[model samples]
Target: MSQSLDRALTLLGSLGDGPVSLGQAAASIGVHKSTALRLLRTLEEHGFVHRLSDRRYRLGGRVLSLAQRALQGIDVRQVAAPYLAALHERFGCTVQLAVLEDDEVLYLDELTGRWSTGAGLPDRIGRRAPAAGTAIGRVLLAGLPQDGRAEEELPAELAAVRRRGWAAESSGHLETVTSVAAPVAGSDRRAVAACAVSAPADRVSPAELVRLVPELLCTAEAISLAYGGSPTPRWCENRCGARPVVRASRT
Candidate 1:
């Protein structure tokens, strides 16, 4: 069973190049076509592979979902590094840029303390943070699509964060850690990523963190706009100054 599972994983990894037919998958796995078909069926049932109408198979929406989340998270890291670096230098605390992934917040990049020498925080490039508790999670939860068909569990607090345009947690997810976060929006005014600061709750009062909200919002908006996406629903609706918001609604 273990050997078969390993072989199946190997076969699935090959699909990254492009779609393949049943015979191709079988050949790649060194198995009979019948055996490949059975393996594909099992993988399809688990949302790993999707069969097209023409009988060729490709990575499924489940896979694409993971990929999209990774892209958004990485994009934020790319776009927000300078701002985060300056912010960390000013605030003298660790900063993180993260995005939602499967009901969790994944850190894409982080800037650590001067005294700490960037060695304490885990290498969280692809790690997941609990979506229910972190400030970034709250902002992302708030900005996600609210329809019943939404892919993730969008709780009410996250929804409220969306309406309010920012989120914060005081020792909510981690003991002694307080974070203030803001959403990064796409052209739809929907959030595509999040930016946050993590510090000792006692050192940074809620009022001080609240004061940072506008700056964080500006940073997020700048990144979103730099990516050619709308910064907010109000921006999309023409409530703020800029070129009239291009409607991101899929016609």
Candidate 2:
């Protein structure tokens, strides 16, 4: 590696521990204060570091923002696969992981329930669908910024999803299908993805689907926790209450 580039990276890594004085940074990177100042100045210009009132340097806001974005971009399918598979195993319903991208729901991964031959499911991995029209999409959109939305201005269906902490949808054009979805949040408490269970209505009736809310929520919350977020506040208060969740074992 070029000496300058190596020194620059070393300086940034040191700042991760905490704020560092100019002399401290120089010593950590085996460079002079002048060199450290130049490195810090360059990083500052790019929003990678910020100088404190005490003349110490610390990681800047850009680092946090970038880190959050990286977490959001993780292959959530891998993180949530076992949990989604568990739902598929227990309920015999199609389970999928979806994220919001380009104002749409993009499926990341899915498990076809054992009961079906995978004939009627419209959703497939990597497919995109309108965000507001699907159960998984509504759950994700509901978790997004409301932007000071007035009660009357917000669609009642979306408002209900936000308040209810989940969403459901039914499709009948081809075959009657029912879906229930809940949010998979990040450390920031924003829904980065949704976990959903879908099946034909004839087999899993709407009322039966409603009854599966507990399991759907449990699966979603487990995925959220595994993804480094806490369980939903309402669920934790009511059904969870500081109790530890046991995830499906991975062999």
93 in model 1: Cα distance from truth in Å?
2.5
Give the RMSD in angstroms, all C-alphas superposed, for model 1: 11.3
lDDT (CA) per prediction: 0.72, 0.80
Q: Kindly give the stretch of ten consecutive residues in candidate 1 with the minimal lDDT sum.
A: 233-242
Model 1, TM vs. native: 0.60
Candidate 2 least-lDDT 10 residues: 242-251
Q: Could you give candidate 1's per-residue lDDT for residues 53-145 as a string of tens digits? A: 989988777776886576554555666677677678877766777878888887787776443433344445555778877888878877777
- RMSD vs true structure, all candidates: 11.3, 15.0
Off by over 4 Å in 1: 1-73, 115-123, 148-155, 233-251
| TM-score of every prediction relative to native | 0.60, 0.62
Name the top TM-score candidate.
Answer: 2
- For model 2 the TM-score comes to 0.62
